[model samples]
Target: MTIKSNTRPVASAARDFLLTDSDFSRVRALIYQRAGIALGEQKREMVYSRLSRRLRELGMSDFTSYLAQLEAQHDSAEWQSFTNALTTNLTAFFREAHHFPLLAEHVKTCAQPVTIWCSAASTGEEPYSIAMTLIEALGNRAGNASVIATDIDTQVLEKAATGIYTMEQVSKLPQERLKRFFLKGSGARAGQVRIRPEVAAMVKFGQLNLLAPQWGLKEPFDAIFCRNVMIYFDKPTQNRILQRFEPLMKPHGLLFAGHSENFSYASQPFRLRGQTVYELDAKRGKGVA
Candidate 1:
């Protein structure tokens, strides 16, 4: 009696909470709608991992339950938590060093009051770098220069507004610049540094979701540092945002992009001025590629 084994192995569920396919799709759609972040299929695990902490914090047992709460009220505080969890904020002082020198040169020639916008103010680094550049370029006159820093993530905006950093964060800065622009922390705050009041005062911080219908910028800027942010959006989305930026800039305003982004397809009113930098062209660079 040769009895063949007909037993089927039972499938095991993932530990802690089950993140079903339905759950992932639901989450992907919601995040894209709220924040314009395109979460691909590969991000399923990342979404599960990042938002899992949120679930635990809210005593939620599964993604279904957690997402339900988020969907129920689009304007809830949980929405902020969800956005904060997903938004990537990897930045450092002088991430693009070359841009500052060009910026200093641009500021030197501006006839009107120079105004610049750091479109992605991640943890204060980029905006602070701009402030330092201006200070060096215009000396004490830099205090009068205007900088508006904005980010979609409220959590990062709060951190940026504080202008505080770890010692290692400012390590790239020259010793003289460090001593001039930042204060060394002591006692409980040792190993940390804070941007000096004067430098911090040069910029203002705000929460702005670029996907919104209205951007709330009152006047056109002389220079806009929208670095490294367009990589997250699809082509059409990128084109739409670029078109929106065109009218917002002065006749020859500069637009600085992230290293990985290319505006050849979307940029109409801007021409290549430097690597990842564009200058306003009223004729939309029609004849010039």
Candidate 2:
């Protein structure tokens, strides 16, 4: 008689996703077209770590298959998650401190109501900073201002709209502004603060892609804060985005960008007026009509 035989198959370890050149190119193109960001070879690990999460979330075991789904599926949650995961949200209250004084000066020069656009407002700090600046500038006159804050990242926008931030996040805020505009958390709410309604009301947060066909603004702004955003874009994308912003600014309106960003290739519509600011010289155009 022969003894019965028992056999079991061995399982393999999880596959490591090594991005191929084509995979890199595909993801770069997709992110560029949708979010206006350019990834250099240096960001290989960033692409892998960020995009790998999307693959895992969608139950895709490989980057190749995940990318195929990203291309074919018109409404894929993976694509949305990829965008949310990849965006850089480096921000804090009173960031790049110099900008506040400039904003105060601009507000002082204007006799009319002020409309400020905080483009690329990550998690709401920049727009909130603008509001605080206006509050300091306008004082009792603060009611005459509003900030239109927009960003392409919906996840960040939602967090921004809530106007809640961790204590570490608000640590950079000036003491007076912190006391005046924010409410510190209690027991269960430790390590958090909520923006006071008056300050929060002054800002309107929404989702806006700088690459969109139209900006959908009903009024041209007196000042546009697009700081620290263009660094991720290539030169051509940067030029195109700057061109779109030009017409939306009021004539002589100030355009602020990242300290590292410059409009060297931009059209003659804007003239360099300061270290990181541009002045709109083009003929004024109607807003959102």
Candidate 3:
């Protein structure tokens, strides 16, 4: 038997919220305040397309009232819905593979306890990759290495903490690494696997709004991976975020950004040492040793 596919477009009210510039502006601001993402003029339709679901879900008539409700609530579950709608989380295991080899090499030379921060650690693959790299490089000393994984989205973070994934999610991992680090599920838990307890323990996950003036980190990190996240912010907010993050890096510590992000504006404080990587200046004092 053969199945025939239907090509008729489904009816949608998705465009209803996006038809007005005023609605676009409100949405742009909400995204900026919540996630430091700037929606440009051309993004009016994109904003409308993304947020119309909230209008339907909240049973609101239009984007204006929905945005007003979002603003009125001091802290609401709607923010999660808003963020979930607006933010783009395109991440995979060992993406930008160059960075992992760089991490392994760097860890081999470090004498002190290493703490690496994966700033936009969506779903935890990056931090887990860091853990695996540190283990490979430092061997018996891997226990001394720690990774802090953060994102503004709490929903993904909860999933990251569980470290359970379908086979496809673990497909990129080498067979040996996969077998070493993941425990395969069976029976009712079939087709899923969880990270080994030791590897999972190396990471700490938390919610962070990078735009906030004060980040609650108690110690400086030896390295920071803020990759693929800065493209969303405007220049000023990007500069502000860099200013805030710079002080938290150890002198001579490494900072890695997305391939598209650059530190040219903040070059006086950090020297661009490699592709999307910067090093804190020697003038900065030894931080949190």
lDDT of 2 at 215: 75
All models: lDDT?
Answer: 0.83, 0.81, 0.80
Full-model lDDT, candidate 2: 0.81
Predicted model with the maximum TM-score: 1
- Residue-wise lDDT of candidate 3 within 197-250, one digit each (tens)? 999999999998788766788678878999988889988887787777766787
Clashing pairs in 1: 228-258
Cα error, candidate 3, residue 113 (Å): 1.4
- How do the residues 151-213 of candidate 2 rate in per-residue lDDT, one tens digit apiece? 988899999999998998888777887899999999989999999999999999888888888
Which portions of model 3 miss their true places by more than 4 Å? 1-19
Q: Give the TM-score (vs. native) of candidate 3.
A: 0.89
Where's the lowest-lDDT run of ten residues in candidate 2? 4-13
- What would the C-alpha RMSD of candidate 1 be, to one decimal place? 6.3
Q: Enumerate clash totals for all models, in the order shown.
A: 1, 0, 0
